[model samples]
Target: MERKQIRALGRRVKKIFIEHDEVKRIWSRFDGMRTYIKLDQFEDEDEEENDDDDKRNLFLTGLSGVGKSQIGKRYAKSVPRYTEIIDDEEIDIIPVIYVELPYPFTQAEFYKEILKALGTENFKKEPTVNELRNRVFHLLTKQRVEMIIFDEMNFIMRTKNFDNQSAMEMLKKLSNQLQLCIVCMGTPQIEKLHTMEDEYVRRFGRDRIERFEKCDEKFCELLERIEKAIESPNPIGLHDQSTGLPQLLHYYCQGRIGYLHLILKESFRLLNVYEENVQVEYSEIRLTVDIIKQAKFNLFRKNDHLITPDNVDKKEYMV
Candidate 1:
């Protein structure tokens, strides 16, 4: 790719960071979670009752490519890191700490991950699980972290040595002991963690991130926003008069924002290669769909139910 082509591709890729309705919703939820954390933190310490039993934990689940991780990162960045006055001393408070769970994780590995996220240089050098856990708790409390977000939480289920019950216990213990909010983001498979036990289900509230439905008004609005975000020298009619762009995209990408991103990135790359002044047309989009179909053969094969308009039912796609 030449300099201009590379620049054009870079511009298109940068547009992926645009905050849509989904991103806004995630932010709203994060704000609410922070409010709850504040309330719990300031509760009467002398009260005989244990109000901390009420879980302020959030479980954010969605299918792959629905922007779960992206929204989590955005929320993390929005939190202001500052110092708080406590007992005549200034203590550093990290409003949010985001960590991604490693695959085949164990309880020890999980705490090690938290220690690593806290910027501990020799975290792996901890001799025992007790030491690791103590270090994690000490760092989180000392730093005064309001919320801890665990991304790719579904890895708990895939771990060969760890069972779902043990993972749930660990999470529950952390939230109860730390007195801070915990947000877990992962694929829909993580929903099984909630279903494994009633205590788990009661403690963690669920938040779902869904893809764009074909016939929904928001889908059309999203398309318009996406069109405006794309910068082109020549005017581009993204949608065809016969079949709307939303419908076409739904059929090709199965309403996945990640797949749509791939299609658009490839489309822009194609325009950079052939057209002098980059402008996207309905024909170019159609060609891009064919190219994506060939490139993502396995994806198309798996989601064959979304391949045609006839297969898409009114109940599922309707607003």
Candidate 2:
């Protein structure tokens, strides 16, 4: 196949992005958070110093590839990208500031990461912890950031020199000082934060992204969405008699959206390779399964949980 043909197929596959009920629910929660922040800002001029008003922070927990980051990015993009005026001066209001937490980050390192995410030129420069903290506070306020989202928050737990107590303290302090809504996205490990401290628990609301289980109506609906997205000459029906691929895919992917996406992308790639047409069929899906399995095995090795029966919930697929 020509490189251009392959690239075109890739583009078609990428267009298969689907937003389901879960995404809407997450986005709604973010909307509520924004409302709370706006109310806090309006009612109190000294809201930044008032620790009495509980922080309307959000914690998004899920396994990898359950679309937490996707939902976060979508919600962030929905916020108007513009500036605000304060005291006759123009202030750039970044409605959302999204930062991915680096593994094993200290309070200082975390601030530096935020600076880098904010496009600071000398983010790597050796600044004192206080200096960094001050800079972050100034930038966030000056930029008029309404919310700060930290994705991959589980890295805080995975860090070798991590101190949960001090970290929690810093986060609480920052929330009170900035008075900006904070959103944390990570795997199930972040649930540990809720148990670490009462203040921390009180500050954030938690939501989990569940996997698409086998035999569920949502699973079939997701397949239908996928079928519609694929621009194939032949109708691609994963739920229909020609394929009945939804069940097989649910089993093979262990209900992971990421895995399903990989399978579909590979299926499209295979179609491009041999058929020279965008025709997704049962044979293409079946052929792509092995490719997905092998890729998963090569990347994750023994930890390829998709192939492990234990990863699947028996109650959900027992029938």
Candidate 3:
């Protein structure tokens, strides 16, 4: 071939090689296993014929990174599509609104945060907490919100004794008065919502929402899918059996969905930046590992006081 022709052929081959490699890597990252779709269930907006004005609630409990938010997003997507058809108008759809609970030092602060979220800036000027709450409720009700996703109920769980009780009461009241489906997405601590006082537990019905548990098969399937999504040749290693991808991921992220996404995105970006022969070499994996190790070390080192027996309590392993 001529010089120009040879260069063109080489460029085409490189593109093909990169595409093939990227495909495998992406597949490993987002296979169906970890994505949390019920194979038998189809996505539909009108899955539940909930009153448009009334809020429909569902709680998604899981470890920090086991895919609850992804499921929440999927459900959020379906709501707008279904509502659009039902309303038969070009209705504005926010689709989903995610709000992490503000860290509340005082019971009063909890109410203040809720007021701020609902745009009631001068809430303290209001006559009563109930009045301020009512005003906020009316505002949200006017927005035609389909659902309110509380992304970090764990924050409330971690509150001090007095603040914890008040926060829980406010949460329960918010769900009841708004009649919105309040999906509490949080870590394992959220289970306290179930085992707590009867008054709080009564509203969140036992059958309404369940906690997420990782089965061995499902976990392995998720790992396989993540590997396929990331196009990793050996997505998992034999060492994974004793401290496999799932365990490592759980340890690194506390199985939190948001953390997992963040880590995976960073890992993928690193892979893209350091490609060799159209593949992310083992060195890239080592780099990611080192990064995680350092992070774990820093967290344990800095937050030693928080690492009580009730908490991570693995300071010795941090090294």
Number of the top TM-score candidate: 2
- Candidate closer to the true structure by lDDT (higher is better), 1 or 3: 1
Candidate 1 Cα misplacement greater than 4 A, ranges: 1-11, 48-55, 83-92, 121-126, 239-244, 271-311, 314-319
Error of 1 at 29 (Å): 1.7
What TM-score would you give candidate 2 relative to the actual structure? Answer: 0.80
Tens digits of per-residue lDDT for model 1, 1-319? 3546446645765567658888898788888887887876566887764443554788998877777777887778778888878899876678788889988888777988887667774833545888888878898999888788999987988887888788888878888888888898898788888888787777888889887656456766665666667644444444432334556565556666777776666665554434556653423333344544454454445445333433566444321
Off by over 4 Å in 2: 1-6, 44-55, 83-91, 123-125, 269-304, 307-319
Candidate 2: clashing pairs of residues: none
Better of 2 and 3 by TM-score: 2
C-alpha lDDT of all candidate models, in order: 0.71, 0.71, 0.46
The per-prediction tally of clashing pairs is 0, 0, 29
Q: What is the C-alpha RMSD of each candidate to the true structure, in Å?
A: 5.2, 4.6, 11.4
Worst 10 residues of 3 by lDDT: 206-215
Q: Between the candidate structures 1 and 2, which one is better when assessed by TM-score?
A: 2
Lowest summed lDDT over 10 consecutive residues: which window, candidate 1? 280-289
Candidate 3 per-residue lDDT, tens place, 227-265, comes to 444443333441243544455554455433345445554
